[model samples]
Target: MSEDGVSAGGGKMRRRDLLTLIGTVAGSAVMYRAMSAMALAGESGFTGPIKLEGDPKGASVLILGAGMAGMCAAYELRKAGYKVQILEYNDRPGGRNWSLYGGDTYTELGGFTQKVEFDKGLYLNPGPWRLPYHHQAILHYCKVLNVALEPFVQVNYAAYVHSTKAFGGKPKRYREVHADFNGYVAELLAKSTQQGRLDQAVTREDQEILLEAMREWGALDKNYEYRKGLLASERRGYVSDPGGGTTSAPIPSDPMAMSDLLKSGLWGSISAGHIYEFQNTIFQPKGGMGMIGKAFGRELEGVIAYDSKVIDIHQDAKGVTATYVNAKTGGPPRKAQADYCICTIPASILGQIPMNVGDAMQSAIQALYYDASIKVGLQFKRRFWEQDESIYGGISFTDQPNGMIGYPATDYFSDGKGVLLGAYTFGPAAFEYAAMSPQERVAKTVEYGANVHPQYRDEFENGVAVAWHRVPWTLGCAAHWTEALRAEHYDNLVAMDGRIMLAGEHASRLPAWQEGALLSSLDAIRRLHQRVMTS
Candidate 1:
C-alpha cells in the first residue's frame, strides 16, 4: 500500500472506512453527533420567532386541542387580528406538557383516578422536561412569556450506569466507566501510532502531536498508560480523600480492565451527553416544564374553552363547524363555527374523532401512529440520592425495564422531600408498563429502581405513573414517524385541506418535541393566513 492510506488487512483504509469503524464501536448516538458536526444531519428548523404577516379581514379560526401546537396557533393568530378560540378536552391547558402537583387528580381511561400526594412545592413533569438550547422557537416563547428558566444538568459524573447483566448487577459510577473507556481507547491508539501501525493514516510529524494529545486527553502518565496513578485518579476520582492533615494522602483507584469494562456495557451510556439534543447548557422552566404551558394558558385566558370535547368536525363551502360536548359531563352537542380550523389534537386520539376531509388527509391521519410511553414520579421522604450518593442532578441509566431514573434538577440539597423520575420507559417496556395498573406501574418502578439506588426501597413515599397509551385525552405519546411514513403522508398531513388544516409535533420533522409543535403551528398559521388574504 502507498503511504497515502493506512493498510488494513492488505487493503488501503480510507477516511470513510475509519468513520465506519468508529461508528460501529461508538454506536449510533456518537455517529449522529459526528455526522451532525460534519453537516451530514439536519439542523433545527427553528430560525427564531415567526412573523405572521397579512390580515384575516374579520375571519375567525377554531383550534382543536390546547397543547403546545394549538396554543401557539391561538396565541399568534389572535395577535394577528384574527378571532381565535381553542377547544381543549382536558379541564386544563397544555395537553402533554403537564405537571402533576399536590392535590391534583387524574383519572385515566380505565376510570382509575390517582390523587397526587406530592408535598407542596414539588412537581413532576410527565411530558417534556428538558429544553434543548437549539429549540429556539420554544425558548422564544418562554422568553416572551417571561417564564423563569434554570439550568438542567444532562450528565453528572457521580450518577450511575447500570445493567443487570453486567458487573454482577451492581451499578457503576458514570465517571469511572467514562474515564476508563476513553483512557483505554486513547492508549491503544497511541500505542498503534508508535508502532508505525498508523504510519499511512498519520504523518510522522502529526504522529508526534497525536501521541502527546492522547497522553493528556486520556489522563495518561509519562508512559502513556491508563492505570492506577495520580493522573487517573484526578479524572475517575480517588478511593480516599486528600486533606490538609498528615494522614490524608489520597489513594488512587485502579482502573477497570479493558476486557471487563467492555463487557460491562456501561460505556454505552457515557455518550448520552454527547448527543446534540442532550448536550450541556440545557434548561428547564422554573418549578417544572409545565410552567411554560401555564404561562401560555394565562396569556390566552378567555379564548380557550376548557373541558370541551369535539365529537365531530365538518367543513362546508362557507366555513368549518366543530360539534363538541362538555368533556366531564354528558350534554347536548354544541356547534362552533369558524372560517377556518386548525386541528392540533394528537394523532392517537385524532384518528378516532369523526372528521370530514380529503381522502389523502384522512389516510394520513390514520397512518400516523403514536408510540406508548410511561413515566413514573416517585416522591421520597428525603433526597437520598443527593444526601447519600451525592448525585444532585442528571440521569442514571439502566438496562432494566424502567430504562432510566432522573434526579431532581431543582431544590438541590433541600432538607424537605423531593421527587425523582423513577422510571421513563418506551417501546416494549412502556407497553408492558401500560398493561399494568397505575399503582402496579409505580411499584414496578420502585422495584426496578432499587437496582440502581437501594434507597428507593426505604425512601419511596408515594408515586404517580402516567401511561400515555391509557390516558384518555391522548391515547398514546407523541407521533412515531418512520421515513417511509413521512415520505408517504407528511405532505398530505400538513397541506391545508379546504378550510381545515393540521398542526402538531407530528406535522413537523422534529417529532415528540415542543419545538416541533411550535414550528408546525407557525407554518400552518402562515399558510392559513395566506389563503385567507387571497380569498
Candidate 2:
C-alpha cells in the first residue's frame, strides 16, 4: 500500500483492509525467503561518474535512438556543456516507456512502474507479474524533471490462480504462484545458516550448491523457468540452464525454436513460459508513463529533436560522420560531423545501418531480436476498475500476447472517469498484430480488455485504440529481451570495433529496463570518451 493508503487510483484509503488482504496470500513467504539469498549484489551498482578531462572541442555529440538511454545520455552531456544532438528514429522520445494522454490520468503502454530497492532489492514478478521497485532511472528522471508520481494503495492483493486456463492465459495470481514460496525460502535460509552457509562468500561452488538447493526448494521452478523461457541460450536465469546436457529434458532437436517446449516434446507440462510469474505490486505515474517522457522531453528543453532521424553513420581516421534524415521533410538527408556517435538503436535496426563490423561480429548483430510489441491504448469514459488502482489488477496473463491491461478510472483519476488500456504482443503474435489495421487493433484491444476485466466491460463499450504499431516513428512499443541474443551475442554485443558504440536496455546485462539503459549509455559514453582521451 502507498504511504497514505490511497489506492494507486487515488481512491478511498484502505490500510486496514489491505493488512487483512495480505494475510490471505499463501505463498509470499516462500518467495521472499528464497530470494533473500539471491538479492542484488551489495556492491554499488555504479561507481563514481567518469569526468571528462577539460571536455572535447567541437565535440558535437550525436546520440542515436532517443529511448531512456539516449535521453539520459543527452541530458548528462548537455548538462556538461557539450553541443548535443539527439537523432531519434521514432517521432517522440521514451522508447519503451510509452504512455497515453487525453484524460486526467494517462495510459501507460510500456515501461511499467515499480519501487526499486524498497526494503529489499527490487521486487520482481515471479508470476502474473509486476513489481514495487522497478524503473530506478525513470523515477530519478521524473524527480529531476519535477514530474509528480502518485503512490498507489492496493485495493486487493494481486492474485494468480493455477486453474486449467493458466498455462497459456494469465497464469493465476501471486497467492497461487507463490504458494508457500516465502516459508520455503525462509526454511532454506534457516538450513543454510545451520550449515554455516548463510552470509558466506558467494563462490562459484557456493552458487552451484545454492542453485541445487533452490531447485529443491522450488525457487528455480518459478524464477529459473521464467528467465529461461525468454532467454534460453545462456540460461542466465534458470538453474538448469547453465549445467547443460539435460538437467531434466528429453531435450529438443531444435533448441532455438518454441516447438521444443510442447508438452510431449521435452520438459512436459512446463516450458520456459510456464516458469515465469508476475509480482502484484505495480505503480503508475500520477498521470501516465507518457508524462514521464513528456517530462523528460521538457527537462531536455531545446535539446530533443522531434523529427530528427539518424540515417547513416560513417567513421574515418579523424572521427565520425553521421548522416541524418529530417523526418518532417521529404528532401535529402542532412549530414553532421561529430567527435563521437553513440548508438542506442535495437540491434535489428543497428544491423541495417552500415557500420564497419566485419564477418566475425555480423552473426551476433543479426541474432539480436527485439520482442515486437503492438500496444493499442483504448480510451473510454467509465470508472472501469473503479476505485481499484491495482494497475490492471496487477494482472498477469501468460496465455496470449494480446492480453488486456488497464487501471481504474478513479485510480487513473477521480473525475471524468476513463480507462486507458492496451495489448502487449510479441514474436509471431506481434507480427500478426503488427499486420492488423488500426481499426482492427483497436477492436481487439477493447475486446480483450473486456475479457480480462469483465467488470469494466461497460467502460470499453466505445473505446478507441491509440496504437504504437501504426505510428511510423515508433515501429513498436520499445523493445524486449529474448533468449537468442543473450547466449550467442553477449560477446559480440560489446565487441568494440571503435566504429559504432552500442547502448540501450537490450544492450545491457539487464534487458528492457531503464536502469539497464542508463548503465549501458554511461558505459558507451565513458568508453568512447576514454578511447578519445587516450588516443
Candidate 3:
C-alpha cells in the first residue's frame, strides 16, 4: 500500500476517488465535510441538453405567458412533434425579461406613464440582468438563439462600500476593507495558534503550515503581524502607485484597525460577490437580457399570440381550454384549446384567474406570494461615474433607501451619453417606493443617488423607475416561497394536474431567474411528453 493508504501502483488517488472512498468507508456527512474542506462543493444539477425521446404523436399543447419558461416549452414541444401555441398578456414576447430603451414608453398600474429618453444604443434591463455561469439551461438557449454575452462585474475591488453611520459617512474602496478584514482575522488566528490556544484543534506540524499559509494569505510581516508596510500595500494597493520615471517611489497605505473595520460594517459588502449566485464570471446579454426573449419570439413567430391575456383555464380528461381577452382593447373574451396546457403565469396573478383544478392545486396557487422590488434607470449626458469616480462597472452598496447604485456594465470609456441603474431596492423599501408616483420615485432615486455620485444633479438628463408591484402584467416580482410553504405546497404546484401542468420560476427551486423558468419548463414538458407517448 502507498503511504497515503492507496494501492502501490495507483499513484496518488484522484480527488473524486478519494471522495468516493470517504463516502463508502465513512458516512455521507464525513464525505461532505471532506469536500467542504477542499472547497469542491456546489455542483450544478443541470445535465446537458434535455432529450424528449419517442414521438409525441401530434399532441397539441397550449402554453401561457411568452416568457423564458413558456417560450422554452413551445420551442422544445414543437421540435418534438407537439403542436404548440402560446398566449402572452403583453404586446411583446418577454414577460418580466424586459428592457427599456430610447422611445420606449411604459404606463404603470397607477396610470403614470414615462417615455424613455436614452440615447440610441443605451438601454436598461428592468428585470433579470445578471446571469450566473452555472445556469446551463439558459446558457444553452443563449447559444441556440445566438445571443452574444459579456462579463457582468459583480464585484470590483476599486468600487466603494459606504455606510451612513460609519467612517464619518464616507465611502471606502472595496479592496482596502476586504484585505484588512482578512488580514486581521488571519493575524488573530495565527496569534492564537502560537499561544497554544488551538493545540487541541491543530497538530504541532500542521500549526506551522497554517502559520505559513496565513502569513502569505494575510499579507503579514515575518513576525506574523499585519501593519503598515509594502506587503500590505500590494493587496490593498498603495496610496501613491509606483511609476517608471525620475520620481519613482512607492508609499504604502496604512491598514485599518480591526475595531474600525468591524465598526464600519464594510465587510458585509465584500461577501455579496462570494454568494454562489453573484460570483465572478457572471454574464449578461450583449445588448440587454431582453435579447433572449426577443430571439425566442422571432424563432417562434406567429406561434405566440401577443396581447392575448388568459382570463380562465379549464381542463378535462380529454384536453384543456383557455379563455382570453385582448389585454390592450379589453374586447370580448376569446377561447383557445389544446390537448395539454403549460401555464407559466406568476402565482400573484394566476391565483385570481378562474382555473378548474383540484383543491390541492388551488391551495398551492393561493399559497404563494410575490416579492416587491423597484429599479430606477437614469440617463446622463456624460459618463460622470467613469470619468470622475473611475468607477467603470460594478455596484456601490449603501445603507440608504436606494439600497445600491449600479454603474453601467457596457459602453465603457465611450465619450457619449451613458445610463446607470440608479436605485435597486427590495422588501420594505420596495413597498415604500411602490406607493409613490412614478415621477416621485424617479426624483427620490436621483436625490438618494446624489449621495453616492455627486454628479447626479448636474449630469442627470432623464430617468425611468419601475415599481414591480405597479406592473400590470406581473403585479409583483418573482414568487417568494417560505420553507413551510415549499414543504406543504411546492410539489403540488409543479405536478401535472390532470391535462394541465405549471412551469415558471415559481415552480422551481431557483426563483426569479430565467434559468429557473427554463429548467421548470424543461422538466414540465419532459413529463408531459412521456404522458403523451403513453396515451
Q: lDDT order of candidates, best first?
A: 1, 3, 2
**Using Cα atoms with residue i matched to residue i, what is each candidate's TM-score against the true structure?**
0.91, 0.62, 0.91
- Whole-model lDDT values for every prediction: 0.88, 0.51, 0.87
Off by over 4 Å in 3: 1-45
Question: In candidate 2, how many Å is residue 42 off?
Answer: 6.0
What's the lDDT for candidate 2? 0.51
lDDT of candidate model 3 versus the reference: 0.87
Q: 329 in model 3: Cα distance from truth in Å?
A: 1.0
Native RMSD of candidate 3 (Å): 6.2
Best candidate, lDDT: 1
Q: Write the per-residue lDDT of candidate 3 for residues 1-535, one digit (tens) a residue.
A: 2333322122444434654654564587777766763452133335677788888778899999999999999999999888999999999988988899999999999688999998998888888999987787888899999999999988988888888888888788888998898899889988998898988998765565566567878998877899988899999988888888987899999898789899888889888998878976899999888999999999999999998988899988789999999988999999999999999999999999999999898899999888999999999989988898788799988888888888888889999999989888899999999999988888998988887778888999898999999999888899999999999999999988999899999999999988889889988998999888887
- Residues 151-176 of candidate 2 have per-residue lDDT tens digits of 43332224222222434443333332
Model 3 TM-score, all chains together: 0.91
lDDT of 1 by residue, 1-535 (tens): 2333444544556645654665565597777767775452235556566677776788999999899999999999999999999999998888888999999998998798999999998988888999987788889999999999999988999999999998889998999999999999989998998788988998775565566568767997767789998889899988986777788899999898999999888899899898878987799999888898899999999999999999999999999999999998969999899999999988877888899999999999999878988999999999999899999899999999999899989889899999999889799999999899999999999999988888888899999999989889878888989989988999999999999999999899889989899889998998898888888
* Model 2 quality (TM-score): 0.62
Q: How far is candidate 1 from the true structure (C-alpha RMSD, Å)?
A: 5.8
